[model samples]
Target: MQKKTDFYFTYPPNLQELDLATMVSMYRDRGEPRKAAPGKYLACAVTHKLLKEAKWWFGLYYSQAAWDELLTKGSEGYPLTEAELNLLGLVLSSETPPHREYVEKNIGTLPKLAYLIVNDIKQFGFLQEDEHGYLRITPRGERALQGISRRIYQKRFTAEMLVVYHESEELHRDDDQRNDQATLF
Candidate 1:
């Protein structure tokens, strides 16, 4: 049997005044790339879950663009967490804007947890609140959920079901427009 390992994702090393988390948030939320040194990009949509993965960077030199291609857009990365997807699914299932109270009550997730997820959803422009304070799914949100559905429907017969990428890159170039749709391995 293969020795299976669980991998976690995080930002690349940022050789700057800002801390790693802040730098990463800026790059991820603003969609900007920063070059830490010549031929080495520190933070950007192009590179992610970086540096630490380089346990032995002796010969693991790659351009910023290439790194983005491998990690961010490559076979083993996804930008969204499961919580965000769940919230999106809830919103899509409703014919109208689902109230936040309803979502909280139905899911039984703590209000704080639900708030954070909804905040992330709003930040990504996936879902928006109507004037009446009900949560409505945006076109982008629909597309994200639909994209997953479509991919699963197409790959139903196959053994591949690990990766189902969100449709974010094509429309929003500034925030979370990364090429990573799903994980491959």
Candidate 2:
């Protein structure tokens, strides 16, 4: 007779606190276990454990008011530029497509505001352009506002925005330094 082997696995006690939904979302968001069928996503033990730890830091730093201020207002106590706030609010508040002329008149020229709105739409997956070329808020964007009230989604979005801003600033500084060195040479 041949002997049979069985595999066993154990999870850390701390991971028990992360509920199934959060785990599923974390896994899906990370795009792990590639090509997993719907309702069949399985996170590896290491990924599951790390998500458990990450949840703590999510709540530790991000607050609803802070993110709201960052979104509606700009960071560091500076109010969002009139164009920035207006453009964001217009799309978020209305499903109807406002005319391009109206947007340009009220929100300033497209060139002036396009970079901010375009970058936000790309990075956050919160806005989409309609077939008619009108912009609209996506389901994810609606979730962001809803989450703002609950404070969960708000934190994640705000953290992501901060990271992007910091990276852009660092890149700009590096470019400046390179230019200075070129001038010196």
Candidate 3:
């Protein structure tokens, strides 16, 4: 039989900063290639879970341009089209509430722009939109940009939880074996 092992957070290496490319790489280790976007609902749920645990900053790395880029298009790594890049640039530099003219002059329509931004905030959690519809950085958002949190360092380690549960069960089995051995002796 294969040796059983505990799969919990045993390794304590310092977490490193990660970008979207690195995030895709991290997920790849677990079997998937890449998670696509328009993922607002999913991103919101996952990031909210992280935020609830105060781990949002640690668990994810983000770029202002990258996120807005994903919202406008689908992926971030590829070179953006002029319109896409322009929209991304506008969002990255804007503040909370954002400028109406800025978006219209650059992107367009509140609903359309909000749709993208809401999703970005959902995934990344917390965005600063200016009265003029400009998006600046929030403290939380800034932390993500800087790669200061460790939560993003690990792949979403589901196996660790399962391994821990199984390890406990195994310990019980070992205890039963010990009892049996003692009774035999």
Clashing pairs in 2: none
lDDT by residue for model 1 over 94-146, one digit each (tens)? 67778877665443244444565576667768788877769888877766654
lDDT of 2 by residue, 1-185 (tens): 11121111111224336665664443233311233345553233323421212211212221323323334312222223333334444566545765444444454323423343345543566556656657666676545443332222223233222222345578999999999999998
Q: Candidate 1, after superposition: displacement of residue 173 in Å?
A: 46
How well does candidate 2 match the true structure in TM-score terms?
0.29
Clashes of each: 2, 0, 27
Candidates sorted on TM-score, descending: 1, 2, 3
Q: TM-scores of all models?
A: 0.41, 0.29, 0.22
For candidate 1, the TM-score is 0.41
Residue-wise lDDT of candidate 3 within 1-185, one digit each (tens)? 12232211111123234444554444333211223344332232222321111111223422333233222222322212222223343444444445534444443223343354344553454455555555554554433332211122222212222222355578999999999999998
Cα RMSD of all models vs. native, in order, equals: 15.4, 18.0, 21.6
User: lDDT for each of the candidates?
Assistant: 0.45, 0.39, 0.35
How far residue 171's Cα lies from its native spot in candidate 2, in Å, is: 42
